[model samples]
Target: EAGVTQFPSHSVIEKGQTVTLRCDPISGHDNLYWYRRVMGKEIKFLLHFVKESKQDESGMPNNRFLAERTGGTYSTLKVQPAELEDSGVYFCASSQRGLARSYNSPLHFGNGTRLTVT
Candidate 1:
C-alpha cells in the first residue's frame, strides 16, 4: 500500500509563469483532493475528485488554477500566470471511498510541494 506522492517537491517561478504539480494517489483509492496553505492563511481545500470526476471545485480561487484527475489514477494542478499570492505549500491527499456515510476513512497526505512565486 503506497501513500500519496507529489512530484517536484518544490518549485520556484516568476510571476506570469505556469507551473504544473502532480500527485499520484495510493493504489485503489478513489477520492483525491487538493489543498494549499499560503503564508498567512490556513490550509484550504482547492478541489475534490471522486475517481475521474470533479466532485467539488467551489474553493478554487480563480480562473488561473485548474485541477484534473484523468483516469482516476493521478492528478495534476496547474497554475498559469502565477501570482505572488499563489505561493504556498500545495498538498495532495487521498482516501478510499467509504461504504457508508458514517464510516470515516483517514486521508493519506503527500509531502507538500512548496511553490514560490517571485
Candidate 2:
C-alpha cells in the first residue's frame, strides 16, 4: 500500500496570501484526517474525512481554512489569507476501514507540509 504523501514539503507565503496543501492517502483507504502542530503547541486535529463526506471538522481554526476530499480520493487543505500563527507542520493520515476502528492501528502520517507565513 502506498503511504500518505504530501506536496511542497515546505512552503513560505506572505500574510494575506492563499496556500493549498495536498494529501494522497493509501489506495482503498476510507479514512483521512488532517492535523498540525504549531510552534510550542501539541499536535492538533483539524478535520476528518470519511470518503467524500467530512465526518468532522470541529478542529478547523477559522473561516479562512477550508478542507475537502473531492471524489473520496485525494484530499486538500487550503488556508486563505494565511496568518503568522499558521506557520507550522501540517500532517495527513489515513487507514483502512477495518483498521480505522482499531486503536492499535494508529494513523499513518505523511512527512508533513511545513508552512511559514510572514
Candidate 3:
C-alpha cells in the first residue's frame, strides 16, 4: 500500500563525482520508472523496469547514467562523473502491472532526489 519512495532527497557534488540515488516502489507493483528534470526543462523519462527486466531505456541521456531494479524490487540510478548539466530532481514512479502494461493508469511518484553537480 505504500507509495514510491526515494532516498537522499537532495545531493550536492562537484562535477565528476559519483552519486547514487535509490527508489522503492509500492508492494505488488511490477512497473518501475525513472525520470528527471534538468534546470527548468520538462521532466523526461530515463528508464523503465518491468519486474527485474528493463522494459525501456530510450530516454536515458548518456553512458554516465545507469539504472537498475534488481530482483524486481527497489531501484537505483547512478551518475558517474556527474556534470553540472546533470543537476536536477530525479523522480521515481511505479504502477500496477496490468494498468502499467496497458498504460491505463497513472503512475505514482516519489518526492524525487535532487542532485546538484557543480
lDDT of 1 by residue, 1-118 (tens): 7789999899999999999999999998999999998888899999999999999999999999999899999999999989999999999999989667323888899999999999
| Candidate 1 TM-score versus the reference | 0.95
Assess the local accuracy of residue 64 in candidate 2 as a C-alpha lDDT between 0 and 100. 95
Local lDDT at 66 for model 1: 91
Off by over 4 Å in 2: 99-104
Query: Each candidate's TM vs. the true structure?
Result: 0.95, 0.93, 0.94
Q: Each candidate's lDDT (Cα)?
A: 0.94, 0.92, 0.92
Off by over 4 Å in 1: 101-103
Q: State residue 92's C-alpha deviation in candidate 3, in Å.
A: 0.3
**RMSD to native for every prediction?**
1.2, 1.6, 1.5
- lDDT score for candidate 3 against the true structure: 0.92
Considering every candidate listed, which one attains the maximal lDDT? 1
- Which residue pairs in model 1 clash with each other? none
1 or 3, which is superior by lDDT?
1
